[model samples]
Target: MKRFQRIAGYLVAAALVGYFLWFASSNLDIRVLHELLTPPVIGTLIVAALAYAAIIPVTGWAWARLLAAQGESWPVSWLTAVLAVTQLAKYLPGNIAQHAGRAGLAMREGMAGKSVAITVLQETVLAVAASLIVGVSMLAASEPGLAQLPDGVRPVLAWVVPILLLSVLFLSTVHLSPARLATSPTRAMRLLGKAGGLPGARIALPALAAYAFNYLLIGSGLWLLARSAELPAALDLPLITAAFALSWLLGFLAPGAPAGLGVREGILIVLLAGVGSDGELLAFVLLARATTMLGDVINFLLGSLWLSLTRRIAR
Candidate 1:
């Protein structure tokens, strides 16, 4: 069953990759692609890519600090490498692979697998909490017309209300607890561990800052890209970038869909739709995907080759 699932997952992942490749190729608006590839765009894309990579350190720091709470210290270099490499896994299919790879590396580094997994879980929970907080602010700042959304949407919002309340209440409770909780595998019990007298409130400020900076870096890069492409108005690009960030986050969370294969494209198309002609939007999306994927493919090849050589040398 596991083998079959893995095979099927690979098939789906492959199909998505192939689909994007062909879609980009066949629909290549040569003129638009050329314009999008200009110097300023090249620079913005480079900067955007760096920003995307930059967030890894903040995450590594978060993971390291959290693990320190459990009396474990691992090299930031090791953690940083694992974070960067495993990120490639996100573009494929399952997020579990990234977690699994990180866990294996952590285990190999002398930390318990469960402990490392717990740290990963803690980072995810806090990151998610941070995103939710942003979502609330976005909701508040937006026009209330969306509030008059369909009745069906109202129920979802209603559900969200209680969930948010519960989350905040739970966080308050955790905030009041003492620092230094046990490292356990149980999710329910672990919440208490996270909830304890830890400095989560203070930690949240930085985490929020990191998350915002992480996305803003990407957004600003895209803004530069848009400026190069001569796309109109910067007002909503940040929102589009927010949508892109949300999609990227979803890609990160997706099970086995490395970097969210169909996921990134899906998110990007939606975001780009309102701003440009279909021809222009499609061209931009294709170029953006190509730029990032090329770097990833190069890194993957380099890592694979290095691993193979190192093994041969030991023999």
Candidate 2:
């Protein structure tokens, strides 16, 4: 039964790829890919890959600091690996694998206290807050299909849940106080006190900047890829930014969509249909996905190799 389920998942993922490919055919040029992968061009690809790899550590450090803001410290290298692998594990069945990866890291490294859980929750809160704040700000500026709508247009009103959720999160964290926890979770409150001069909002502020910068880098890549593929210059920056942002956010939350392959392209397609020509939009999305995946592959290799070498040197 397990084997059968695994096979079914592969089929479903493959079907999604086939569907994506049909639309992305124009941008999946064999020659362009070869050019991009060549020895001469590989250097530029390496830089992109390294930038992507660096993002994991930077975000991990910011989050690790959030933990320290509660006067706790954990192994960041281990946490970074767990985060990276959790991202890769999202493609597995049910997304249980991904969550397991995160929870397992917490338990294995002696971070099984209530304080760790509190810190983890705080990190999740800050991340979502940052994502949606940028998202909402950009979504309002979306062009709303000027000249013509792309396809599968959902109502803007549907986004209220995520926006509201984000708003509530920001309010809660911004005014968070150790005194508010007097009646509950005393252990966690004590840890917060040990943070000394570091305030909770001080920790929260940096997560916002990190997430926004991460999105900005990825969005710029997508935008440039679109132009390279000859998409419209007059295209709305806000629309692209919002669409790309949602794609990343949803891809993270989505089950069994490792590296967010299916959800990423699928969401991009739907977003494009709302605002750009189907053919052109699909072309650029394909380019964006390829660039992103290629970078991921390189990052995984470099990180894996670096970890292996460091262990050997220590030995």
Candidate 3:
């Protein structure tokens, strides 16, 4: 049954990617993509790519802080290095690979399997909550009328409310396992009554801050990419940030899409269509994705080399 389920997941992911490619090919002009490679645009893309590289460590720090909350504290540097290599797994076929790779690395460092599980879960919840909150706030600030319009406000609330609830629930659950308790089963079930009652488990303020910075870096990189494409100056920056965040969150939530491929581009094209002609919007989406990929490739190679050298020095 598990095998069947896995196969089904792969098929679904492939279908989603294929559909997006077909749509893109029909609407996108290849000539515009070639045009985007001019010297001025290339300079902007390099800047955007560097911003993306900065985001990797910021996100790793957030996850490391979450793990620290669970009593498996590691230096942010080590965790950042580990995550830099493992995060590339998201580009692979199965979504589980990234988490699984992280789990293996943590276990090798003597972290208990259950603790790793909880840490990953907590980090994901915190990250998503931070993303949604920042995204919605940007939208509201950019267009104050959104606050007055039920139609506009409802959709944002629909996502935000549940995410907020889930974050609270997860935060509560994090307290159940006392960090000092040596035994796993016993520690997992020992729930403290309330927030003030548990010292080890308050709120993850550092994690929230880290994720917020990470989101800002991501949005800024995309903004630079938009500028590289010579998008209209009339396009509002805050609105673009909100749109990117919303589209990114939606794409990440989608089942089976590797690193949110196809889904992210599709959503971006739709949201930014008003910024320019259909072909130009399509070019922006493609170039943004390409610039991001360039950053990822550069980081992955550098991170791998760093990790390898560190291991040799220890020996």
| Candidate No. with top TM-score | 3
In candidate 3, how many Å is residue 122 off?
Answer: 0.6
Sort by lDDT, best first. 3, 2, 1
* TM-score, every prediction: 0.67, 0.67, 0.79
lDDT of 1 by residue, 1-315 (tens): 988876775665565556556656666677767767778777767665555556676676666766665567876645665676665765544456767776776687578775676667667767765555444433333333134245576556556746874675457334423233455555655676654324455554455456656555555556566666676552245444555565565444433455566656655655444555666657666555665665455445544565456558769
lDDT of 3 by residue, 93-206 (tens): 757787888789878978888667766766776677677767776666565324334586657766765676566546544544353343345433343221112223354666
Whole-model Cα lDDT per candidate?
Answer: 0.58, 0.60, 0.69
Q: Of the candidates numbered 2 and 3, which has the greater lDDT value?
A: 3
lDDT of 2 by residue, 1-315 (tens): 977776775665566556666666744566654444445334444444455556677677776876676667876775666566555555565655656766776666666555556666666655676666666556655556332332433354346646665665566455445655444467776565443222445676676677676766666555555554456664466666667777667555543455666667876776667455665666566556666666656555655665567568879
TM-score of 3: 0.79
Candidate 3's C-alpha runs over 4 A off are: 1-19, 143-203
lDDT at position 161, candidate 1: 49
lDDT over C-alpha atoms for residue 117 of model 3: 72
